[model samples]
Structure formats: structure tokens, C-alpha cells
Target: MTTTTSQATGSSAASDGRGARPDRRRRGKEGPAVAAVPVVPAPKLRRRPVLVAASVAAVCLGALLGVWTWSSTSNTHEVVALRQDVTRGETITQGDLVTVQVGLDPALKTIPGDRLSSLVGQRAAMDMAAGSLVTAAGVTKAVLPSEGMSVVGVALPPSLMPGERLLAGDLVRIVATPGQQGDLGQEPPATVAATVVGIYPNGENGETVVSLEVPEGQAAELAARAATGKVALVLDSRER
Candidate 1:
């Protein structure tokens, strides 16, 4: 009985020793309990070289366009402009012109403000409105009523002239009509070629006073016919 007890004790001791060694070995092999670290998926390395370059290029282009627009709009010029309304054939005085800053087109013809002094005493070739830009073709230096030409004023009712509006520089003919007695055997009507110079409306008498430029020799005859009020106006073709 003693020996059996001894054997049983020895076996139990051996079993316990084997189990403790295995547990110690496992603990040593596995390090301290590691804390779970969240893995942030390595920041997705999506490289878009084309897209990045395009974005950069777009920003640069926008800046360049803005600068170009500013430069274009800031370009300005000092030019001459009319300060008041001026009728055809009227002389341009200092008071009639002003210097102005403007952005002018390349194709536009403008008289520079520096030439303002030169424009004095020059005649306007056509009717010019207030605030209009003075151009090279707007003024003339030619002596009006050329040496052989004489200006005559003729007043006529609407019935004796064409319905079309008459403007300065129009070519016209003044024709004499028979007197109220109506002479049947009278010679052909007399006609005088003339150029329109100025037109004035006579509101009180319902007549238009037209200033005409005619040959010096014919001026007296045209004046005589016009005084009798038996003449009509014929507008000639204005082409060229």
C-alpha cells in the first residue's frame, strides 16, 4: 500500500510540472497583450497628373485673360470733339471744339486735339451735331462762294418745290413760269442751274427760304425771276 501511494503521488507531480512548463512557454512566446491599432488604409495613392496639370493651367489662363482685358480697355487717346452744334458752311471757332479722352478704333479717323488750333476759321462741310468727334473730312479750307459764284436767296412755297427734303450740296434748277395772264405765245421757260447752300424755314408765311449759289452772270436774272414769285425748283440727281 505504501509503494502504490508513492507511485500515484509521483505521477501527479509529473503531470502538474508538464502542464505548468507548457503554459510558461506559451506566455513567453506570445508578447504582452497587444492593443488593437486601427489600420488607416495607406492614403489611397491616386495620382492624376493630367487633372492636376489641367487645373493649374486653367488658373493661369484665367489670370492672363483678365490682364489682357484690362490692358486693352485702358488704352485711350486724346482727340478733338465738337462742343456745340454747327451748321454746314459755318466757321469752326475755339468755342466749338473740345478735347476728350476716348478709346478709338483703329479704323476711325479722328482729328487730334493738338490740331484744335488749326481747325479755327475752318468751315464745316456738313451739318455737325453737338458732342460729335471731329474727323479729317468734317472741315474744309476752301473759300466759300468761289470767285465766279454768287449766292442768291429765294423764298418759295411748298407747291413750287419738290416734296423731297432739300439738303445743302444738292444740285437744282430754277425754272421760270408764265405770269398770271398766261401768255400763250411766250418763249420756252428760262432755267438756271444752281447749287443749294442753305435752307431756312419761314413758319409765319409758310415758305422756305433757300440760299442758292449760281454763276455771277446768272445771279441777277435768277434774283429777278425769284422776286416775281413765278419760279419752281427742280432737284437734280445727286449721284456722284
Candidate 2:
């Protein structure tokens, strides 16, 4: 029994020694290692470059806006030459620029160059076609003489179209003579002189009426001539 006990005690001591050796070796090899913890992510190196670019762009934009504001505030421009139609027909008023048939000198019937400045605001003599003449009568002024003259509606031949050539004031002779005589076949021609006040053309009825202003006493004879004999228009010479 003693021998078995001694062998058993010796085996246990050997086992304990072996275990202690292994534990000491393990502790020495490890050398007090610390527990592993979660590592923080490194910051992106590209973020610095992106932030600097954004700052520069913002500064540039601010500078550009400042420059634009300064230029607009101090800018000065001339009031370029502005030509507008001062006169127009009854349908037109001031501050209106309508494409009208302006008059050109009759001598310039055919233009050598393509530019035709004079034919801008002239109204048509008749219902104008493309190649028609744009005379002074074509376009009408938006205004008229309020106090100096007036218009009268008279029944006259259409062939006697005035083309609206009568101006503000004009004078001529008015005649009213008996066409046939009672004694024989001859009668003395009678005539008188009056002033042209206005011009009225009847497009619908194909009639041309001349508004005239003359002595009040001659209104009777003038009306009589206008009613009986054919009314004739004679333009006064510039000399008179």
C-alpha cells in the first residue's frame, strides 16, 4: 500500500509542475495583452480638397455678382435718334408709328437704287396696287383745321376727283351762267370766284364734292350754279 501511495503522490506532483510550467509559459509569451476594441474609421483625405474647392467657388460667384451690380448702377446710354410720325389720319393718334405711303418727288418715278425713303407715308391716290404711285393725297393727317375751314357734302361727278389736293386755304373763280338764251340760241357766260375750304370724296357713291368758303352774299348764286350748271374747279395760280 505504501509503495502505491508514494508512486501516486509522485505522479500528482509531476502533473502539477507540468501544469504550472505551461501556465507560466503562456503568460510570458502573451506579455500582458490588452483586449481588442473597435477601431475608429480614418477621415477621408478627399474631403479637405472638396471643401477648399467649394469655398473658392463661392468667393468667385460673390465677386461676379458685385461687379455686375456696379456696372448696372453706373451705366449711362444715349437716347438714340427717335423719329416718329407727327401727323396721322383720324384713325391714328400721336405716338403711333404706322407703315404709310409717304410721298416721293414725281421726278423720281423710277428709283435707281433699291432704297425708297420718300415712299413711306403717302396714302394711295386710288385703291393702290403694289406698283401704284404713293402721292401726297394717299396718307391723311390725324388732325384738321378746327377753326379755319369746314367740309360740305355736295353732289358732283366722280370724274372730278380732287385726290384730296386742296390745302388749308385756296381761292378760285365760281361761274353760274345761263346755258341757253331766250332771244336766240346764245347766252352770256357768267362766273364768280370763291375760296376752297375743304375736300370731301365719296367713295361709296362715286361723288367728288369741293367745300368752298366765299362771301356770304354769293352763297345764293353759288348754290344756284351748283344746282343748275355743271360745277367746274379751276386751281388758282401761285402768282395770285
Clashes of each: 0, 15
The parts of candidate 1 lying over 4 Å away from their true place are 1-42, 80-108, 113-134, 184-186
Local accuracy of candidate 2 as per-residue lDDT tens digits, 81-118: 11342221222222222233333344534322222333
In model 2, the Cα lDDT at residue 148 comes to: 48
- Residue 25, candidate 1: Cα error in Å is 39
Worst lDDT 10-window in candidate 1: 178-187
| lDDT of every predicted structure (CA atoms) | 0.90, 0.51
**Residues 108-197, model 1: lDDT tens digits:** 899988989999988888889999999988999976688999999999999999999887778999998877888735478889999887
* TM values, all candidates: 0.67, 0.34
For candidate 2, what is the lDDT? 0.51
